[model samples]
Target: MNPLRLSPSRVNDYLNCPQLYKYRAIDLLPEEISLDAERGTLVHTILERLFDAPAPTRTPELAFALLPTSWEEQLIARPGLREKVQNDKEWIDRVRALLTTYFTLESPATFEPTEREVHVEVNLTESIYLHGYIDRLDIAPSGEVRIVDYKTGKSPKPGWEEKALFQLWIYAFIYWRTMGVLPKLLQLIYLGNGELLRNAPTEADLLRTEKKLISIAEEIVYSIENVSWRPRPSRLCDWCSFKNICPAFAK
Candidate 1:
């Protein structure tokens, strides 16, 4: 009855496993957030706050300084997180190391981002609306735009990069549709491994991605109406919070 609202993540969830999709999106079940997800949120918050200062003032040391406050708030807001951080000083060290690795790849002071964690959305069709937050957006003097996403984990291996690149393409497609300009660059920064992955999306590439997303949307709608969302068992299930209640693994 309502228009289908979707984000890149929601689409990917359905594509990965419709049953998982139904559990979270359709049934609106609750699941515990992971420590890695909490850490990623903290890192993103620190990076966003880092750029709030003048470009010259956006140094790694300042970014590091921002972490204690950011982390304290996280622990307070999510008291469950205290146990994870209380005894593990290395956890904080690992986050600081990620900040250091970020400096090695690019200087925050070099280019001021037009937006950070920007919420961008577009209506692909009358029934399908796509939306998501981009980690950062940069515009050069010459008018070229760049979309950047940060990964707290390692970069995917050779063949696995396709999925990562596909995610970028989704962002580019949404941006182009919403803004009427193709971005000059799409980048992923993997802090764990200090690796950078960049791509320049062609009009044709984004069009293909747009088509794929629409198709995915249609499939999701069909599954929801028919109550046919089925479980997809895979290695990822080991990390899935819903596994305990999942139809495929239910006791």
Candidate 2:
């Protein structure tokens, strides 16, 4: 059998609902792309491009200027995406607001990212391989590493912060396993509400994350072999594109 490749988002899909995973990963169904998600992609592209300029020139105005070109690049990559949006002007305005919020949180001119959209992959076993893209990776002067991810959505409610950090932990795990160094910090920058959520991960924390992933991978293999993709009903189901075909919700 081919190696089972898992990304953080794909792992989240299986954990959310195995049936949803089947539709996305196994069946390879196309999802209805949301305007909000597209806006987030545009903002991420602008931020990544912002660092290409000289550090002193990486200002909010420069970021704003890159918007048109960044958006044009997106349009070229995803043809017909513009027609899906109800109002292109209003949509661009919202994206601009997100970039504005990003500046208030962090001055791009202050620090240079060691890597942007860095892809890391590790083989856990002969058959299971884990992989993901780190939004930003910074190495401090003292050699401490920091992993930063951008979230275009609001910060999660107080009690749900750990769940929100799960994605970052996976990245930290991959970094640590591959680089042999634990990241000193894992940060989530929420542009929607201009909130910064940070976590200092310990070696033990990453170990637990690795174990959790292995367990999930094992369950995934069993589900595939047994042909038993079970639907997990939750409030998140409302936003799922495959709800109509899900056995748990079938009429």
Candidate 3:
């Protein structure tokens, strides 16, 4: 029997390196998730909980104060890889300030969060299908949907608008199809730096994304069907959390 499989993040890692993907996702390696990743998860949890509360009781101010304190302690306990670039004080203060800035910048009055977690089997066609979890979906008073995905680190090619951003585009489209209404917007929040980036999803945008996904999926299916893949090395191998055990990066 085939196991339940493939979350969006895991699928992304597979795109990064199939071997590493198989080792971590399929083989189930016992590797430590990074402290930085843990920190981001913690931050998202606080922000999500803050939003998910009853509108009458929703409190972004309290959340802004509480979140960074927790994160500050976490940073102190496990400085991790960031210790070199920043001292304990700088890391804690900068993170705290960023949270304060985000609280000031974002208008919780404009919308409410519906942190959607779905593992749906989408019918891409008669034979093709897709599965993923949308991190968060928001709704405006005017009934427009919005998708927000949190990113924790600096991406090497962050400026390019088309850097495999198909994930959020598809997320927005799938959300609308499920709800029978189009999303008004989709945003990517770079939490580490508090840079909130916005993109408006149009009909043409979703169609382009759909075609791209099919192309990428076809590539994956072909490679899996024929077992046709070559090992390639790159920047990821050097800094990847899996570098210690990765065959491509092994000393």
What is the per-residue lDDT of model 3 for residues 167-207, given as tens digits with 9 covering 90 to 100?
77777666655666777887776655667668888888877
Taking all chains together, each candidate's TM-score versus the true structure is 0.96, 0.97, 0.75
| Model 3 spans > 4 angstroms off | 1-6, 54-61, 64-95, 116-121, 125-129, 154-159
Measured on C-alpha atoms, candidate 2 has an lDDT of: 0.92
Each candidate: what lDDT? 0.89, 0.92, 0.63
lDDT of 2 by residue, 1-251 (tens): 78888999999999889999999999999887767778989999999999999999988899989999898888889877878888878988898899999999998888989999999999977889999999999999899999999999999998999899999999999999989999999999999999999999999999999999989999999999999999999998988888888899879
Q: Candidate 1: deviation at residue 172, Å?
A: 1.0
Tens digit per residue, CA lDDT, model 1, 4-114: 998888888887899999988988887776888988999999998999899998888999899999998888898678876655678888899999999999988878799
**C-alpha RMSD in Å of predicted model 2 compared with the true structure:** 1.1
lDDT of 3 at 191: 54
Give the C-alpha miss distance for residue 4 in model 2, angstroms. 1.5
Name model 2 segments beyond 4 Å from true: none
Better of 1 and 3 by TM-score: 1
